[model samples]
Target: MKLINLISPSANLAELTALASDDDLLLLRQDAVYLVYQAALPFPGKVLALESDINWRNITLPAHIRAITDAEWVTLSANASQNLLWS
Candidate 1:
């Protein structure tokens, strides 16, 4: 089953990423985007950043995480058998 992890904030991103499987995807939102910007987390699977969030903060999209639209986020979540939210 494909699992999507939503990383928000108020948690240890490194530890959370460590628990991820190679097949799991990471969706960086809110403050979690900072980690990717800093090149902190080398998640095994695909990494996506919420487009609106990044733009709202006036941050340039990092190479490590692709920006996804709200519609795409819905599709991604729908395709995943499991979704984990961390904040």
Candidate 2:
């Protein structure tokens, strides 16, 4: 079965990446924005981000990482969003 992983706040990309396989679709959100700039794993899925998010302006993400708007994500559960942590 195809899996759709919604990675929001409180989720670690590294840990998720480890668990994720080439078949799994990893959806990055919130602090997970950092993953966009990093190297792409063997996982053959799309890495999406929110266009209105501040991270989109601060980070230089790879082409593979698509920056979508809030409305877009809202329309499809296929997309996910999250809040960044600050401590």
Candidate 3:
């Protein structure tokens, strides 16, 4: 599994699309948490946002996109075969 971390709002969409796979996990953190408001997403797989970031930004993610805690983020990172950053 791949862990794709998007740390900024200006992340390259083309690069993300080229790298993303169905088994990848997309993590929205920092300024990237604002991406949840977009109607279309670059990654088609599971999406997770930092709970703290989401709360800080007051973003309400769609049901399909989950808000994960710091521990959960660490667990995902530990379990993934590959880790990628979009920003």
Candidate 4:
């Protein structure tokens, strides 16, 4: 599946949803971690956030979103069909 790295909260989510497929993975990092505050994510796929970023920002994430480490990020990128950066 595709692994999309979203780095900014200001990025167009509509564009993201359009680009992502149902089997894709969405990973929020940096300022994009703030997007977790939304009631629901538009993408119809798995969602993850950087664990360190979440801790640094002091934000609590919902159960649906998994918090991942830097090592896990590397693993996901290595396994994904494509790694996209949306900043």
Compare the candidates by TM-score and give the number of the best one.
4
| Per-model TM-score versus the true fold | 0.81, 0.55, 0.93, 0.96
Query: Per-residue lDDT of 1-87 in model 2, one digit per residue for the tens?
Result: 133434444455456556555544454556656556556643455556666553645876677777766776655444333222221
lDDT of 1 by residue, 1-87 (tens): 355555565577677767787878888888766656565565678788889888887888767679999899888889987888877
Candidate 4 residue 62 Cα shift, in angstroms, is 0.5
Q: Is candidate 2 or candidate 3 better by TM-score?
A: 3
The alpha-carbon RMSD values of the candidates against the true structure, listed in the order shown, are: 2.0, 5.8, 1.0, 0.7
Ranking of models by lDDT: 4, 3, 1, 2
Higher-TM-score candidate of 2 and 4: 4
**Residue 75 in model 1: shift from native, Å?**
0.3
Question: What local distance difference test score does each model get?
Answer: 0.75, 0.53, 0.89, 0.96
Against the true structure, candidate 4 reaches a TM-score of 0.96
| Native-structure RMSD, model 4 | 0.7
The clash count for each model shown is 0, 0, 0, 0
Span of 10 residues, lowest total lDDT, candidate 4 = 36-45
Clashes of 1: 0
Error of 1 at 9 (Å): 4.2
Report clash pairs, candidate 4. none
Report the CA-based lDDT of candidate 2 relative to the real structure.
Answer: 0.53
For model 3, residues 36-61, the per-residue Cα lDDT tens digits are: 88887868688899999999988888
